[model samples]
Each structure stands twice: as C-alpha cells, then as structure tokens.
Target: MASRTFSEEDLSCPVCCDIFNNPVLLDCTHSICESCLQKVWRTNRARQCPVCRKRNSRDKYPLNLVLKNLCETFQQEIGQRERYCGLHISEFKLFCKDDNQLACLMCQDTRLHKNHNFSPINVAALKLKEELKIKLQPLQKKLDTLKLKDPMMELPNI
Candidate 1:
C-alpha cells in the first residue's frame, strides 16, 4: 500500500488560509480556527457553523485538541523547511543584497538573482544576534537594578 502525503493546505484553516491555531470542531463535523468562528459569531451575531451554516445549539465551541496538535507539528516542520531553497534543493546560506532575501549558492547564480551582491546568511544572522544582545544589555542591567532595589516593584514601561 502506498502511503499518502499531505501538504500544508490540508492542515490550513479555510477562513484564515493559514495553519490552524486553536482549532475547534463544529457540530457539523467541520474543523476551523477558533478565532475565525469568533469573528463570524461577532459579525453575524449567530451561533452558526462557519463551514456548514448549521445552527449550533451551544454558543461555546470546544477546542479540537487533536487537530490543534497536528497543526502545531505541521507549522514547526514548515518553518524548518522554509529555510531551504525551493529551486536549488539546498540550504539557503547566502543573503542577496539587491533582493534583500536569503538564497542558496545555486539560487544566487540564477538569472533572477544574478549580479546581486551577496553575503553569508550565517554571518548576517550572527551580526544581527550580537546587535540584539547589545541592544538588550541596558534593559537587562535595569532589570537587575530593579530586582536589587525592590523585588515587588512594578516595572515602568520603556
């Protein structure tokens, strides 16, 4: 028997066109994101199923934990996969300056990104990470000072 392969579309919420977050199962046996259902309820002022238009007996939509778990797993896998170059089938290790996007070596040589100035993606990422650490240093110092002064003090919003 051949195993079936599923795409991100299969796990996406029809209303949001994104991976389901806080998915809920309707009485009509349809699953949708909980936030999408809330939007419909708020706009239409009715407890109707978004997919089937069936009048729901209860106002509250129970969380579809099984679907929610599947969506989360799918999203994580997608995030990891997105870092790879789709055309070159290689890891995106270069950042094209003209395009302001990451690309693989083969992608950089392609007509689309040819003649574009490039830098190592890892170097750019490391520089950005270091900058972020430097920027957060003041906040960390303030937090430490606040902790030493008063353990129960309310923090002032910067």
Candidate 2:
C-alpha cells in the first residue's frame, strides 16, 4: 500500500485557516483551534459549532491530543525549513524541479543541480498558481452544479 503524504493545509483549522493551535474537538466531531473557538463562543454567546452549526450540549470541548501533536510537529518541520538553505545558510531564491527542492545561490552553483532545471521561486510560484487553477476548474464546476434542498440538512462525513 502506498502511504499518503499530508501538508500543513490538511491539518489547518477551518476558522483561522492556520495550522491547528491547541486543537479542540467539538460534539459535532469538527476540529478547530481552541482560541478561534473561544473567540466564536465569545462573539456568538452560544455552544453552536462554527463549521456545522451543531449545538453542543456540553460547554467543555475535548482537546484533540493527536491533532495537537501533529500540528506541533508540522510547525517545527516548517520552522526548520524556512527561506534559508540548510547547508549554505543563504536565502533560497531558486527552486529545482528535478529534485523538487529549494536552493540558494551557493547551492545552485553546486554539481548536484548542474544539469537540473531551475526556476526562480517567484516564477515557480506563478507556475504552481496556474497549475492549481487548472486543477480547481473541474471541481469548481462540480460545486456549481450542486444544489441544496434544505437549509438545515446535515453535511456528509468527510
């Protein structure tokens, strides 16, 4: 069986759209950042879930320990891989498509990428944006075709 790779976006909170910070699971089984939930509760003054709008009978939300740990690990990994090169300690301005890795000026001059295809990070980002747009087009059309029969209808399990 092939293993699935997960990105930070997959673990992000729906409310803040950031990697889960002190994640809490609601009665509706939706996970959200604790601070975001608190802010919602404070503003709404209700136990209603933000995503599903399901009312919670209990005030206390259980901490999603597994998700919290995963988010922490993800954040640490991202922090370790910031703009700087791992070996050269210089800013990464180029992305090597051959190795699917970011490279700094020093790293790009090395033999590892001598024959490899390289693009500036900004240009690579534009290409990725276009690719994402092409991928999302079909999904967007499918979403447009969907129609709701009832306002209170429960969402399907993810």
Candidate 3:
C-alpha cells in the first residue's frame, strides 16, 4: 500500500487558515479549531457548524484526536526540513562562505564565524546547485556513452 499525501489545506482550519490547534468535530461532520469555534459561537450567539451553517443541539463537541495528531506530525515534518542549530536551536538562515557551512543568527555572532562572509541560504543553495550541474556535465556525457554501448542496461537517472 502507498502512503497518502496531505496538503496544508487538508490539515488547516477554515476559520484560522492555519494548522488545526485542538481541533473539535462538529455534528455536521466538519472540524474546526476549538478556539475558532468558540469565537464564532460567541459572536453569532449560536452553536452551529461554521462551514455548513448547520445548527448543533449539543453544547459540547468531541475533540478530533486523530486530526490533532496528524497536524502535530505534519508540523514536525516541516520543522525537520529546515535545519536548526543544535547549540542555539535556531533555524539556519545563512551560509558561511569561509567555512562552507550553514549557520544560524546566533552562530554568526560567535567568534567562530567572525569576519567570515555569508550569503542567504537561498542564494547559497542556488550557487551550489549551479556548480554541481557544471561539474556533472562530463559525468553525464560519459553515462550517455555507456548507455549507448549497452542498450539493455537500465541506468538510474542522475
């Protein structure tokens, strides 16, 4: 079986436009942030589904534990993509040109990277990608030659 992919919208609360925080399931089969639901109920003076406008007789709704867990895991996965400094627990936003390494703002202030030139992570990533592409051209040509020599061989795309 294959794993399913969920977009940010799938996990987001329509009221808050962000990931679900303490989500609650309504009688109408819709889910919303608990706080957001409370705010809407208070403002409108009615217990109803915000999305479908369906009136709910019950005052309390069940907490969507499964959705809450999914939202937390998704947030953690996103955080994992952005490298963080172990020492300061800050996101790496810059690349130290002299050291050829990623650095957080705290690391930039330290003496270890003193006087070293730095570039934004995006800029550094683009520069490195271009360099890698240039370096791989000859290797790619050689692989093409080999592929021609052995037509039956299935080489993985680089």
Candidate 4:
C-alpha cells in the first residue's frame, strides 16, 4: 500500500475553503467547519452533508477531533516555515544586511545587530532573487551550450 500525503485542501472545509475550525464529521464521511455547517444548515433548512447532499437524521454530530488536530498542526507547521525564528520563536520581519540573514524584531534591538542596516523581508527577498537570477544567467547559458554540444546531455522534462 502507498502512503498518501495531505495538502491544505485536504484539511480545509468545503464550505469555507479554509482550514477546519471545530470540524464535524457527517454520516457521509465528509468533514466541514462547525460554523460553516451551521450556516449551511440554516440557509438550506435541512440536515444534510454539505459536500454530498446526503440527508442526516441527527440534530447534532460529533466533532472530528482528529481532523481538527491535523488542521491545527498543519497550520502551525506552515506558520513556522514561513517566517518563524527558532532562536526567538517569532516572525522574521526584517533582513539584516550586514549579516546577510533574516531576523525577527527582537533581534534588531540586540547589541549584535545595533546600527546594522535592515530592510523589509519581502524587499530583501526580491533583491536577492534578482541578484541570483543575474548570477545564474551565465551558468544557464553555459548549460545550454553544453546541451547543444551533446544531445545526450539533454534533461528530461519534469
């Protein structure tokens, strides 16, 4: 058997198109946010699975604790990946030009970074990307030349 990987869509509620908040599992085996389910039920005036339209007889459904926990964990992981600073456990909002590194606001006030030039993370990222593109141009041209010299050197399309 193959293991399946879940994405944000897999953890999201069909009704809200967002991560599940207090998700509830329907008899049809579909999960939806509790608030979104309430809104749908009120508007439709029916107890049914929002995804499949399968009628549900129960007035209340049990919360999908597993799915809820998965969603929360996924969100935390994504947040940590985005801009989190491991040292300070805070978001990286600035780029330290002197040290050429990302830094949280707390790092800015530290003695080590005092008087160091800083830029917004997004601005610094764009500048770095542009610089990288300029640097890679020559390398890319060389690779293209090599490919032309040897047909066997051609890379497969992803």
Model 4 per-residue lDDT tens digits across residues 35-152:
9988989977678788899998787889999999898888777766767777787889999999999999999999989999999999999999999999999999998898787776
Per-model lDDT: 0.82, 0.85, 0.89, 0.88
**Model 2, span 1-158: residue lDDT tens:** 12337877779999899899899999888999989988888877667888898887777788999999888877776776687797997889999999988899888889988988899999999999999999999998777656443333566757
Considering only N, C-alpha and C atoms within 3 Å, which residue pairs clash in candidate 1? Answer: none
List of clashing residue pairs for candidate 4: none
Per-model clash counts, in order, read 0, 0, 0, 0
lDDT tens digits by residue: candidate 1, 54-133: 88877777899988888777767767878888887788999887887899989977899868898899887887799999
State every prediction's TM-score relative to the real structure.
0.61, 0.51, 0.54, 0.53
Cα RMSD of all models vs. native, in order, equals 5.9, 15.7, 13.9, 13.5
lDDT of residue 76 for candidate 4? 79
Cα lDDT tens digits, model 3, 29-97, are 899999999899997766768789889888889999999999998888777856877778788999999
lDDT of candidate 4 vs native?
0.88
Candidate 4 clash figure, as a count: 0
Question: Which wins on lDDT, candidate 1 or candidate 3?
Answer: 3
Worst 10 residues of 4 by lDDT: 1-10
Itemize residue pairs with steric clashes in candidate 3. none
- Model 2 is weakest, by summed lDDT over 10 consecutive residues, at 144-153
